[model samples]
Target: MSPTFPARRRGKARVGAALGVSATLLAAFGTAGSAQATSATVRHGVFPTVSGAAQIRANAVGQASSDETLSYGGGIDGIGVMSGQPKVYLVFYGSQWGTQTTDANGNLKFSNDAKGGAPVAQMMFKGIGTGSEAWSGTMTQYCDGPLVSTGATSCPSGAAHVPYPTGGVLAGVWYDNSAKSPRAASGHQLGAEALKAAHHFGNTTPASNRYAYYVILSPHNTNPDHYQNAYCAWHDYNGDTTLTGGAVASDVGDFAFSNQPYNMDSGAGCGVNFLNSGSAGTLDGWTITLGHEYSETITDQNPAGGWTNNIAGSPYQGQENADECAWLKGVTGGVGNVTMGNGTYTEQGSWSNDTDQCALTHSTVS
Candidate 1:
């Protein structure tokens, strides 16, 4: 099959929230930071230009409270942090995605329809030539509110980008594998050791169709009714009044995984659900993780790319992540930074078709 997604923005575009940026921190990141998880970095080398982290803060618009704080260490998710035209394997579990199919390589198999009738969680993520890097990263205290809900009711101030997985981190059986079972319970991603093992077993390759599973549970999970509306349940469940263990949907089918860490019954290590430990997971964390690993693939494939852009604006209010100025643009500009609730400002630069890297004239993705 082909990797042709509908490209429609169904879920609300998440607003920037609770992310802090600093020059010192970003400078030490995967790129200029000098760390290569795979040969991709060693091959092209790491980016060596920019330094420090950009500030990102979403302010109080109308619905949210004026007293919420969010901080995120960039690269929260193990996203490879590359820079290239990388393709994320989006394993959707529902009739819409069809049934399980295999490629000639046998490296990546697919079963779009998840077991248990629920909407199969979308498992689209950045990839490395060898394996996957994700996050157990934090989202503590940086959400605007719920975007869509089945029956969620937490008092939130803004619109949420990703909703809680009603199915929990454990997406489905046949088609969609449970991302929660990875060795690194936090990122729910396959670590360096685990990836080599999968390679040894010939279960995967370093080319097309690499899938990274991310969790977006139902409203009940995000502690619906709580202030942050976060998912505080994983093991014993948190004592929030809005807590709903939730039901498993029956619609899932061929997309289930029998593999460890990817399968529940297969003895795979389940996720720790950082929320269970009491934290306000931010949308910024999830988004940044996705973006970081994404850019890495298309660029230098490692920390050797010429990341790091020049500065432009000053911080908005007192918020660190908020009120950032735009500098780098496109592939060369760099890939880091955060934004406020409003996108007037952004952290780190991204590959915007609107303009080239480091272009002063910004254009909307229209």
Candidate 2:
């Protein structure tokens, strides 16, 4: 069957919350400090760059006061890890994508690299779950929440904290040749497409996708949700809305999906990493957005049920783990190289309530 558009998220665009930039750290990296996860000294080989531990620790230390102290926005869910490990499946939603090329490491590349293609995202996801990377390990604090509840802060006696994402599988990739282009697609349609991808990959059962998420990458030049005007990209589970998609409110279980826009908006607007500027940074930004959505999905697979703050008057209430620190970088600390297996790509840092700060390098997995 052809892909169908789901209902709009809120009749209009839902803007992502803008975060205040950190001046203290940015000055540390300097102007030329802006670069992808790969190190300046090394060309393309997998060499570990500076973990930025010193900078992150120093930054956290300075914020020791309540004025700077940071804590998890809300309660944590003890299911810490995604059951087994972190697993991801890439779904190229439209046929507009051109030929596919394979890299030396058996990863797939795409002709539409600028439009948030496979090449950019592959490198980002490659080494994420491995090596107890900072981004993944930062989520350890969330494991300390209650066993089951909407707004949990402390874990019940004998309960476990949310485990960090140690390592996992890339799962696989599937380009929906049968599905039509997703130009001007609605949010509901995006959810439907995710369900289709799940079925196509034989991940129909919840067990197969317990800790899995479907990333729907739209072709370049398409506006998934007014990308240039409203928000870069957003993550949410299926059946959350009453849109006219395949999965209705009566759907069996929650299905996590992210509407990744075409890189046309480039790095600045949509979170792509075009070396912090220009159209060329499409892949980098795409990977950044992917990591953001991926992090949120693992922590809050079903949105608020996972780990979200709902306290009144709290600035972060209703925000997920990644949402709290979205687009906010630590300059010398935010962006860094993560050597998963063989690839390293510069991705953004997530909120670490444990340290009450945002860090690019997490020394301990907890």
Candidate 3:
């Protein structure tokens, strides 16, 4: 992820330039309950400007004729999905998010007093796992290999297939008031706060957190770890120092997290591009960005060690699957609005190595 240095703030470290560790290291030090997660590649998209948009469009990675895969020397073992029932927990990190309610389908709904994007995020997470949505299956095409940097194409025999989150769970929600505001919460601070919530929910051990990820949301009107400028949102495990104020690799487990602010502050910069429908407060971008991070987390749970391209000098390299297809909309294998059981959502496509294309739907896991 490139850093968005605010014009007024000249010397601060760009939040996108944070240090990242490997899942192998986390495995060496993490306890059983704290294990499953590993350090992930911090893939992020820059805020789009007219000139920037033109440049990115010219250089953007287009859909491939078949699934794409990087060589083994690039990182670690191959990348794979959660391979189990996935789980997600939502954290409203500040008081800015007010009360919450439950909709008819047992999905969490926030009060109107809260930012309009909040409830939409909640519903998208819930609705995506149901109705046999094809959006998610787009991720199943990726698989992990047993050897590091070997360029071995096939997954090891008996390797777990990227299971569809058939019965994915929205384990719980927490409104933490301790932060009170996102004005100064650093990336590390956000990870620590997520740890606090994990502790509160007894999700501390790796076994307890298997296939589980935490999403830390900053409120509107404030910034968390430079979100307004540097990047819209990002997903990473604990212990990645590359991010300013991130947890130390040795001290934390393989817990995954993403810090996002309400996108109204900077539309394309904060992930409200393409199908934003010309509304600053629209939930389309919010849900799409969230889905992007979620898909990346499960596939590249520990960053490059999972699945990532490592081409030199190419922004697209080292990018997770979703990053490759970030803003490609309306073309074959690009972004489009799809109807789920709850409602229609404008989401982007994910890269699939199987067909060597970016696809919105996968008839089967392959």
After TM-score superposition, the amount by which residue 52's alpha carbon in candidate 2 deviates from its true location, in angstroms, is 27
State, as a TM-score between 0 and 1, how close model 2 is to the true structure: 0.71
119: Cα error in model 3, Å: 1.8
Ranking by lDDT: 3, 2, 1
lDDT (10s digit) by residue, model 3, range 1-366: 211111111112222223222222122112212111122212232222223323444544462333244322222222334666667888888766666667676655556334367666767777776787888887665555443233443455555555676644467777776647657577677787778767877786766655778888877776665544334566766645455554534223467677766766665544455675556326666777788888887776644445654433343534567766666666767768866767777787877766666778886463
Q: List runs of model 3 lying over 4 Å from the truth.
A: 1-54, 60-81, 99-115, 145-157, 248-252, 271-273, 276-281, 313-315
Alpha-carbon local distance difference test for all models: 0.21, 0.52, 0.57
Measured by TM-score, the strongest candidate is 3
> What TM-score would each prediction reach against the true structure?
0.25, 0.71, 0.77
Residues forming the 10-long window of minimal summed lDDT in candidate 3: 2-11
> What lDDT tens digits, residue by residue, belong to model 1 across residues 250-365?
11110111011112111101111111222222222233323333332222121111121112121221112111212223434432333222121112333221222121223211
- What tens digits encode model 2's per-residue C-alpha lDDT throughout 243-301? 32334431324566777777555434445543455654545656666776787666656
- Model 2 weakest lDDT span, ten residues long: 40-49
lDDT value for candidate 2? 0.52
Please give the ranking of all candidate structures by TM-score, highest first, separated by commas.
3, 2, 1
Please list the residue runs of candidate 2 whose C-alpha ends up more than 4 Å from where it truly belongs after superposition: 1-83, 114-116, 144-150, 154-162, 242-252, 272-282, 330-333, 363-366
